[model samples]
Target: MICIRLFQWGIFVALSFVGCKSEPQNQDQKSIEKGIERIDVTEHYVSDSYHKRHDGFDWVAVSVKHHGDESLWVSVRSRADQKKPTCTYDTKAFRIDKNTYESTYDGKRIRFEFFPTSLTISTENPDDSNMLYFFCNGGATLAGHYGKIDGELDTQQIDLTTFSKVLNLQGIGFNVSSIEKDNKNTLTIFTFGLENRDYNETFTIEGQVVIDAEVEDLNSDGSPELFVYTQSVGSGSYGNIFAFSVNAKKSMSQVYFPPTSENPKINSGYRGHDAFTIVENTLSQRFPIYKEGDTNASPTGGTRQVSYTLVEGEAMRQLKVLDITEY
Candidate 1:
């Protein structure tokens, strides 16, 4: 779609090296809403540095996709061997200009400048390039000019073993990464730029896989909330959410999400495959309803959409059902 949607929300293993297929932007899509500007770019680029090595080429590739209304999904990787990559980076870069985006990590700013047929990567301060060394090995740096690739980039070439996302608002940020090991996924979230470092936390999610995560100021409190969506591996694909709210930009607290099974009013015919997004200030969840005798592949019942509002509870914040509609 790379522009962050109405509310800004929110990686793979590279095993192979392939190019990206450029996709056309939809002209009818709105580029700005409520003064929120978005950069529209969905393309791939590659570097020729690989040709320098005869034993194993230093191949670097980049993929940029429209994320929401104001962000781009940017992924960069460098491979010296077909079995493993030397450098890998995956995160959301927020739009700074019509064709430029930037993301801050490890106290450094990495910028992406886009052109008609090329992309240039650089650091805000040239000396800050050293911070990027954390993701690379063997003296490989992600900062360089890459040429646009005309073909589709085989995403499978990048390692999908780990998923990562970076979200920021009001000077608070989070780096969320999930790594799967032995059928269990360990979700690690590192908070940065927080007024109180003690608020940062890491979690271990067993048996389920993280599908996606999002950040938003759901209560208009000026601080953001983190929403992590996950699904169990198997035929069911049952979805679950892990969320936290920033407390006055100092500490963080978990936001309770009522299970569908406990909420009898909305649980009828519920059977996984659910998707979620924030609409205005509410959390919106939509899923296909399954009637009796309905196979997992098909659901005769119409779709059910539910919206939840963030409210203060005695102990913690909770997402309370605001409304539900089916059609």
Candidate 2:
């Protein structure tokens, strides 16, 4: 009877060992199946060649098919080349988060956000922060930056073409008036609360008409100064630039330009097609100067380079002038 009992125990132990071994085998099979499923899903959404190929300027071509609409396509080039890293993504349904769009694929995620003049893409991995991309709207260049954060990818895109038109300059408590040109060769500027409320000023340019106007912070102050470039109606390509600064009271005041007598070496009037540039709190302009009888279209003179520095008392005074030289 004891011998019979030992034989039964041996059989039971062998069966238990086989059962434990088979259980692990089943688990291994399931794990393999799951890995295969992940690969299939990844392949369905992204090309097999792109997998693990995240490196410099990774270009992503997103092809989106919307219901009852023609297919939409967009190509994004990573900004990694610019030291701003970003992650790449296959086109997928996205959710809006505040001013951003969020999307995910293959266990990775991406986010896009927009600023007044730029768009940014971010990811969770710090290493991925170096990736960056370009987004062009209506052929206008929209600069981008990259960073990393934890959470669902968030993205926001703006029709930059429209942002410039509908942007609320008034919502920020600053009001600007349109530049008006009068028949008398006078340019009138009106603004409210830029320096003082209900401020109006008229600038007289003898024979020039206002052609372009832009606002820039030449002094790198929080407030931007206005720059108006004028062209001679009679002499094509001949132009002059005028700059205005906002006073403490928000009043638009003209920034000073040195008189010809003060700097006899540099040309008196501004000319050429290139606008002036402000760098390191200094404004500079280099352009060809036509002789008395020469129009910009038929220049027959030397070029003048002038530089100015922002001096105390809210003025831009000539800092240095180079002798006029042949172009």
Name the top TM-score candidate. Answer: 1
In model 1, where is the ten-residue run with the lowest total lDDT?
A: 12-21
**Cα lDDT, all candidates:** 0.68, 0.35
Over 74-181, each residue of candidate 2 has an lDDT whose tens digit, in order, gives 122222233322322222223253334443322444553323222244554545432322122222121223221222111221000100000112211222222223
Q: Given candidate 2, what's the lDDT at residue 131?
A: 31
Compared to the true structure, candidate 2 yields what TM-score? 0.37
Cα lDDT for residue 223, candidate 1: 89
Q: State model 2's lDDT.
A: 0.35
Q: What would the TM-scores of all predictions be?
A: 0.62, 0.37
Q: What lDDT tens digits, residue by residue, belong to model 1 across residues 1-327? A: 111134343221121122222232333322322134332357667776533434554566777776666777676655423655665667667888877788777567888776665666778888886665555555656666566777664443444545666677778877777766565678888787767674556677776776567788999998899898887677777778898999889878889999875789899999887767777788888888999999998999999989999999998999999999999
- Candidate 1 Cα misplacement greater than 4 A, ranges: 1-161
Reference-based TM-score, model 1: 0.62
Candidate 2: regions farther than 4 A off: 1-183, 195-198, 204-206, 259-262, 268-280, 289-302, 313-327
Deviation from native of the Cα of residue 158 in model 1, angstroms? 6.6
